[model samples]
Target chain A: MIPAAFEYTRARSLADALKAAGTRGTKVIAGGQSLVPLLRFRLAQPSVVVDIGHLPQLQGIKRAKQGTVIGAATTYRDLLDSKLLHNTHPIIAETTAGIGDRQVRNRGTIGGGLAHADPASDMPAVVLALDAVLTLQSRRGKRSVPARKFFKGPFATAMKKDELLTEILLPFLPQGAGTAYESFEQAASGYALVGVAAVVAVSGGAVTHAAVGITGLADTPFFAASAAKLIGRTPNKEILRAAAAAAVEGVSANEDIHASAEYRLHLARVAVRKALTTAAGRAG
Target chain B: MTQTITLNVNGQALKAQAEPRTLLVHMLRDELNLTGTQVGCDTSQCGACTVLLDGRAVKSCSVLAVQAEGHKITTIEGLARDGTLHPVQQAFWEKHGLQCGFCTPGFVMTTVELLRDNPDPTEDEIRHALEGNVCRCTGYQNIVAAVRSAASALRGSRRPGAAVSGG
Candidate 1:
């Protein structure tokens, strides 16, 4: 399969990438795991592809007192190799490991995954639950976009054409907080049919805070505020099950060839229940 | 637009003229005539186009040649040296890991990375590592055995600093 002809420009630095993107009909290429496939299928025909895969400024994992900042270009392989991620935010490592196999993960980047906003991608739900912040920059200036508002819909984001997502800032969990990501993968495509990411903060035997993020069940990955009703209550099995059931309270399930809306709703409940239980257990 | 891109494949530098949209798999196979890497699925689902890009396995079909300009690439042809087969190739040959030999190169390259990362992977790990590569034949039993055997052999006979070519 041949992709549509386009001009390719490699950006040696962040400034160069932003400048290239400012041109009309230009798209930033990172990792190329998602965009290249789209290009091959003619689903996306950007006249100019700004390659930012080699930018050094956007290629490391750094943790400060505020939170962990992951360079947008950091590949899944880099995340897996980070001791800080494994120890501090192990859910990121666990979720990334479940993405497309070794080859895809080797070339896929966190920023690309989040920016692509694939409903079935593992990172969106996890990042949403983490309340991560995305840093967008351009030749004009820079601004921060919260994960909650970053994703507009499937394959759509709040980012502008001239801007580039340069970093993702994920806040560190408070003490007694634990997070887990669970997914039910569709065997053939290796994508999550239903995935849930839960963050539970327990204090003095009570659930102080609970955040539930769900994917592959709607037009976009979303937080389940209804599920967080467990706050100020003991998160027992029954309560956790109720929270899981409330996960898709106002959202409509996505129907596809692999699953019906009813079936996806069912799987969402199961995944949420499992994720919350595991997260609560880890919290203790 | 056509561009002359230089690729370091199998420890040798080769130059080819390719359009900005040219995939690395096409450059390796069509331009350089290194046909060991196959393209079973151009959409990146199948691992037949898998190769090492800077010491890691990536689907060549999914990466544009322009993106890989300055990176080191290692394909199946880069494994052997001086008429001696790589330990992985030897294991596959002895274990009948392949039935048609079409998917052999991809499996070999993927296994090279799996073993390098985890020298002694269990049966489940081997299966997980091979999730990207699809083999319609062999049911993957022999392929797992071949990877296990190759891991054992490499641990015993591998020469110091003799890494896979271009890796």
Candidate 2:
């Protein structure tokens, strides 16, 4: 499974990486979990591969003004080991733990995953629900993209080929908020057949903030606007069920050998219901 | 184009020339002549190419040889010392953990990490830890038993006055 021959640049710094990335036909390689597979399969034949996995600037989880700033290159294993992430956004850790397996987690990066924008990947829905912001860097300049606007389609993103995703900014959840991610995974690949992330903030026994993100049910992971229906309403079983149903309303499920479109929608509804219930229970 | 990359394998600093596209598994088996690591599923789904990268288990097939430049890589061949099988290897041998023996290296390497992180793991924990490695034989029962045996043996050796068995 050798990849096609390509020039490799081991970038020593952020500037070096950005410079290399700006070159035509250059592909950034971080962690190389997803990109390596694509390279091996000949699905992507970049003339140059810029290795940025070891760049010191693109590492670590830090406390920020609004919430937490997680380096895009931070691995899932590192995320699991972070007490700050566990305390501030436990759902990130919880969802990451279920991605692929131990070996994959050791090498997969959040930035790589988000930039790859695999519709079946778990983190897109998570960041969407968390309302995370992504910082993109390039030789030209820097810009920020909210997670909601990041995914354009399967294996596509708002990022330009010359830009690199540097940091993911997870905004602090509202005071009374709790977040949870739920998924029905394909048995073999562990990719989500249907995944949902819910952030519920309850205030005075009423739902104040409700955001739902869904994946594996369409061409791209999306913020389910129908979740707004729960706003200002008491989050009882009936209300939660209705909101879950509405979350998948108008969504066109993707069909494949793994599941039929109808079945995928069914799983999406079930997952939404479970995620919302669990998140509401954990809400302060 | 080939690049010379130096890697620390089994406490030895070795150098090999490989293309940027060369996978670490190929470099280990072909260039270094360490064939213990198998490539069951080249797509990284199967852990047949599992190896320790700086004391953590990672699928070598998924890692580029160039990416392993500064990391310490420990393969199944590195487990034994002076012809004596490592405890985890010995446990698998004694417990008949392997039937076909094709997936042994990966399972053994993965267990090396599992036991290192957790000296005493429940059956479910062992099963979950080795989820990446797949064994077609023994129904995973003997494999689980082998990990349990190795864990206890390693724990016992750590106690005071216990015979210091080589890792």
Candidate 3:
């Protein structure tokens, strides 16, 4: 199916991209893998397409004093090859690998996936668990939104239409921190039916702190706060299982042709338990 | 307005004027008229449209034609050298890897990427790497065997233009 005819503007820089996006009926598209499909399905019909493919300002993976800052337009393939990010946050690496086939990975951008605000996306939950910050820019100004606040609902984000998600600020993982991502991938679309990102900090062989980020099982990517509070105190199997159950206490997962809401909830519980176990084991 | 994008396909630089949203599969099939790159699934699920973009295999359908501009792309047609079959092709032929020949291009492109990533992949590694590239015929047993054979043949032969990699 052909995408509806629209004016195309290629942005060479982030500022230009946001400026173009400020125009009426314009949409910013990077790594068209996700947005193009929506266009083909008539789910999104923007009058003008702002291409960030040429945006030099929105590219690269670098180890910085703050953390590993990832340009929103960087492709998944680049993320997979990022040595710094691999050493720092393997959860991002692990979660990105679960996304679709090689073609999808080669073309899909992590920033696009998050900004698209797909509740089923694996990155948002993991990024939230990592405490990654998103930089959003518009003609008005720039603001940094913590991952928790960035995602508002399923297929919904707090991003203004004219704003550009230019960078992802992933803090350097501290030593003794263990992170793991577990997901039950939906076969057809290759998104998570439910994804859990667990970050556990261990002190002297005991649980010091834990951040439980659950995605694809709720309207928004969120910290399983109730579950985290309980699971953070102890890392035993019984507690882990109970925390997994609590993570889904009120989660209303999105249901489609692939799986039912009940099935997704079950997977979310299983995934959380598995993720927590992996995280605890890997904790330094 | 259309943009002029350059692509190196089968060792020829083909410049095509295309819409910003044009899929890479269209430039190859319509402009270059090199129909080897098949568009099996436009949504990036089916690997039928896989091609090498800057030495990496990617779904041509999922990317805009403009995205590939100024990059080296290798289509399935460029697999052979001096009119001889590439090792993977030879292995597939010897091992009877094709049933309908629809998914062969994707498999070939994936194998190219696999060998580039891991030259000596274990059978299980081969299985994991090729799992994304599906085959309807032979139940993939013969295809797996073909890849195994191709990996061995290409490893020792340091042919001028050939590189050993993938499952």
Winning candidate number (DockQ): 1
Clashes of each: 0, 0, 5
Best by TM-score: 2
Decide which is better by lDDT, 1 or 3. 1
A17-39 per-residue lDDT for model 3 (tens digits): 87887888888888887887787
Error of 3 at A183 (Å): 1.2
lDDT string for model 2 (B101-121, tens) is: 999999999998888889999
lDDT of each: 0.89, 0.91, 0.81
Tell me model 2's lDDT, rounded to 2 decimals: 0.91
Determine the C-alpha RMSD for candidate 3 after optimal superposition of all C-alphas. 2.6
Clashing pairs in 2: none
Model 3 CA deviation exceeding 4 Å by range: B159-167
lDDT of 1 by residue, A1-284 (tens): 69999998888878889898788888889899999999999999999999898889999999877799999999998999999988779999889888999999999999988889898888989888988889999899999998988888888899998888899998998788989999999998889999999999999889987898888999888878786689888989999988898877667889999999999999999999999999998895
Summing lDDT over every window of 10 consecutive residues in candidate 1 chain A, give the lowest-scoring window.
A243-252
Against the hidden true structure, what lDDT does model 1 obtain?
Answer: 0.89
C-alpha TM-scores of all predictions: 0.97, 0.98, 0.93
Model 2 per-residue lDDT tens digits across residues A143-169: 999999999999999998789999999
